[model samples]
Target: MRTTALLFSLSISFGSLAQLQPIAADVYRWKDLKIEKEQTRERRQVLEGSARDLDLLEIHTSALEPGKSPHPPHTHDDVEELVIVKEGNLRVTIKGQSKILGPGSVALAIPGEEHGFENGGNTRVTYYIIKYRSKLPMNIDRGKQAGGSFMIDRSELTVKTTDKGSRINYFERPTSMAQRFEMHVTTLNAGMNSHPPHTHRAEEIVLLISGSGKIQIGEQHKDASVGDLIFLGSEVLHAFTNTGQEPCSYFAFQWN
Candidate 1:
């Protein structure tokens, strides 16, 4: 019902938890999430929690009125953030450099840097924030640049064909605070699946972007729709299937 608020303190750490913590109990449904609203913006935290080796792992979606920002540009000591523009033009600002990012675009705000976003478009701007911190020492991401900020237009990535449908990877490169947070756009044709139910060492997050489907976590299964998030903890058996009449597409990311 609450968020780690972009500026929240990380005095509490989960990085020291026992290894192989199962995250199957962390499934969050958008329709059932609590919403927080202000005069200029509103947001919902789907998964505002933690993971092993991760001190803080929070994700939220925010909608800001035209010309407004969720918060003023500020730097934090321990958190790194990613802003993925879902709709409208989100003007991402890091220090002085800025970019007008459209839907499907992503921007990274590294630790120890001043960064924020404004709705540069005529309409309300919606974007998702992925904020986190690792227990071990990390860095302020310079990315491929020296300014500690990075942006990627999701449309520019080439789609790779999969047996079920197709997938397009985003950045494979490491961020200042992260080394293996891989992101991609995956689609499954009706009645198709990317892989059989399985398990691995990395933690997985599947953010449903469109269409409806079903997910299996261990022996448990459930129906999933847009705005739903399917999580698979390290070594937790999980799989996704496109059960709808139409193809189901989702944004998939994993952190090891």
Candidate 2:
């Protein structure tokens, strides 16, 4: 009877900590986001939930005033962070190394790394932050064995122009939270489709930065504008097209 009672108690305790629901494939419009004003910056909460292979996934954006910082350098023991600059110049420090990144730049901080950001330009700096905790066990040592932390300046990447559009290749690497993390920017010409409807095993996010477009996932379609984000679940049929009169550019990132 005592063993059975203990099991019941354990089950009840475990049930209280239920897993977070998986995020659905949808669009988060920039205009629809409610801005939360702060002392140094304004924040827009994007999404906060679990993904297919991640235990916790959170995304948000911040616009920092000139010479302002959201917080001091911090370390995440289990979560990995990815920051993408959208406007103005950002000063980012990772593991004691600092760099000034312009719009379209990216920074990645794996588990157990100290990182921080600040607006280094005269104008306000707008950037997105993506944090994820993988369902797999966190292996800090393995992450360090890889590249640890790094930043990519957009100017350093070569843009390959295609007949349909242009593509800027970013990084494809393994992190503490994902077996594979891949990112790139695609500029689709006006009225051009990014590609035919396709599916992949990795969940993906499309962050539109320029012009306007439409993203279709399954039977649902959503129009996107600058600062809007489109999230596609794993193996979900999705496609994107430039619906505006000018070219559209967006960052496409996927991770397992």
Candidate 3:
């Protein structure tokens, strides 16, 4: 009877752990997503899994009609969220300050920061949300010292022109859940490769904003269109090439 009780307890403990496996390095197409229509908006779940440094990594897209908000401003004590505008205009409020941002804009809300979003334009507004929690303990003070939560427009950033294309730096700072977080936009001319396959210690995400391309991850090559996303795990060799006739642009964000 004692042995049976011990076995039952062990089974329950193991079952309580997350059954979701770690996400692989691959491209997630936008068209492949299934939309779930809400009362005032539409939602599409992209990916939800674990990463090397994060206990949870989840991504989703939301589209809100004119003057609609998903919910009221709230605070997340354990999760950090990143919002990237894909289309239309978004009014993002972080800690009481609200700003209307157009496509390619980004908002970073650290843990415990009150944040909310809504469609600020007459048309529909679409954006991607990246929610994550670190494997380490949450440090709200560290994030606050690093600048707390904020939003930035893409046009406000400086663009570095190159022979192949241009690169725009977004930000690089520490968050409550990560020691280092960096984001940038890279545009590649037709038939141009962003770079030779490269590996980094931080896990990275490539979110295509314009044109089309192909991403090479390990031994696999996958096609990516506008609104598609590619996630590369730590130490994974990956590269992106503009396969279309026109130039392609993508946002690359990494953290550990």
Worst 10 residues of 2 by lDDT: 13-22
Instruction: Compose the digit string of candidate 2's lDDT tens values, residues 126-227.
Output: 999998988889777667777888999999999999998999999887887777889999999999999899999999999998999889999888899999
Which residue runs does candidate 2 get wrong by more than 4 Å? Answer: 1-19
Clashing pairs in 1: none
* Structural similarity to truth (TM-score) of each candidate: 0.85, 0.92, 0.93
lDDT of 1 by residue, 7-49 (tens): 2433233334333233444457878978899777999887755
Error of 3 at 49 (Å): 0.6
* Candidate 1 lowest-lDDT run of ten: 6-15
Clashes of each: 0, 0, 0
**Candidates 1 and 2 compared by TM-score, better number:** 2
* Displacement of the residue 220 alpha carbon in candidate 2, Å: 1.3
- Local distance difference test, each candidate: 0.78, 0.91, 0.93
Candidates 1 and 3: which is better by lDDT? 3
TM-score (C-alpha, index-matched) for candidate 1: 0.85
Per-residue lDDT over 1-256 for candidate 3, one digit per residue giving the tens place of the 0 to 100 score: 9999999999886675477579988888999999999987899999998999998899999999999999989999899999999999999999889999999999999987799999999999999999999989988998999998989998788889998899999999999999899999999999999989989889999999999998999888889999999999999989889999999999999997
Model 1 residue 238 CA deviation (Å) reads 0.7
Ranking by lDDT: 3, 2, 1
Worst 10 residues of 3 by lDDT: 12-21
